[model samples]
Target: DQQVKQNSPSLSVQEGRISILNCDYTNSMFDYFLWYKKYPAEGPTFLISISSIKDKNEDGRFTVFLNKSAKHLSLHIVPSQPGDSAVYFCAAGKYSGAGSYQLTFGKGTKLSVIP
Candidate 1:
């Protein structure tokens, strides 16, 4: 079973509107959650992250919310732009015994911002 899951395969939004992406995780060991945006072929770029200690984290147009009890998280983009169209992946990581971080990633949600 996938530890991290993105229920929606894709999302479409009009420019200047808000885009909300959802994710869920089954691993309670995961304390650190992150959102990444990926282009066609390039690697995913880090977007926002929230530690289990915080309920919300915001940066500019991007906001991330984490609910530890619910095992759920979401990313909100305000005034979505054409340039914001990309595939978003939700990832969770935890510190391992070997001092390494093991991460599990959701499939992805492709966001299309129509102009």
Candidate 2:
């Protein structure tokens, strides 16, 4: 079963507009979460993260918000630029004991920013 899901396979936004990416998880044990952005050939790069303890986290033009009760999260990019166009993955993590952590990832959503 898929623990995390990105309902929208793709999204498009105009340059200088706001882009909102959504994610949902079925696992309640997830205590930490992260977002990753991947280019065509490079590896997925860490974008932003939010812990269960906090509802929101922001970095520069990127912000992530968590709604624990709804088992949902979202990433908002202000003035979405062309460089921000990429595949975004939502990852949820939990402590599996023995100093090990486990993660579950969504398929990813392709974001396109129009010039």
Candidate 3:
């Protein structure tokens, strides 16, 4: 069974608007969640993260919210720009003793920010 799932295959947003991407996980052991953004030909770059201990985390234009009881999480980006158009992946993980994360990722959702 897939542990992490991004139900929406794609999303579109107008410039300067808000874009919200949702994710779900089945594994209770996952204590950390990460969002990654990928361009057409480049590697996925880390965007935001949230620890299960916290309900929310924010950095600049990005914010992540975790609803542990619902086994769900979401990434919100305000004032979305064209540069933000990319594939976003949701990853769930457990922090290991070494402070590393063992993650399971979703298929990813393609985001289009229309100018």
The 10 consecutive residues of candidate 2 with the worst lDDT sum are: 95-104
Report lDDT per candidate: 0.96, 0.97, 0.96
User: TM-score per candidate, in order?
Assistant: 0.98, 0.98, 0.94
Write out the backbone clash pairs for model 1.
none
Put down candidate 2 lDDT per residue, 13-63, tens digits, no spaces. Answer: 999999999999999999999999999999999999999999999999999
Q: 104 in model 1: Cα distance from truth in Å?
A: 0.6
lDDT by residue for model 3 (1-115), tens: 9999999999999999999999999999998999999999899999999999999999999999999999999999998999999999999988666877688999999999999
Clashing pairs in 2: none
Poorest 10 consecutive residues by lDDT, candidate 3 = 93-102
Error of 2 at 36 (Å): 0.3
Mark the regions of model 1 whose C-alpha exceeds 4 Å error after superposition: none
lDDT of 1 by residue, 9-88 (tens): 99999999999999999988999999999999899999999999999999999999998989999999998999999999
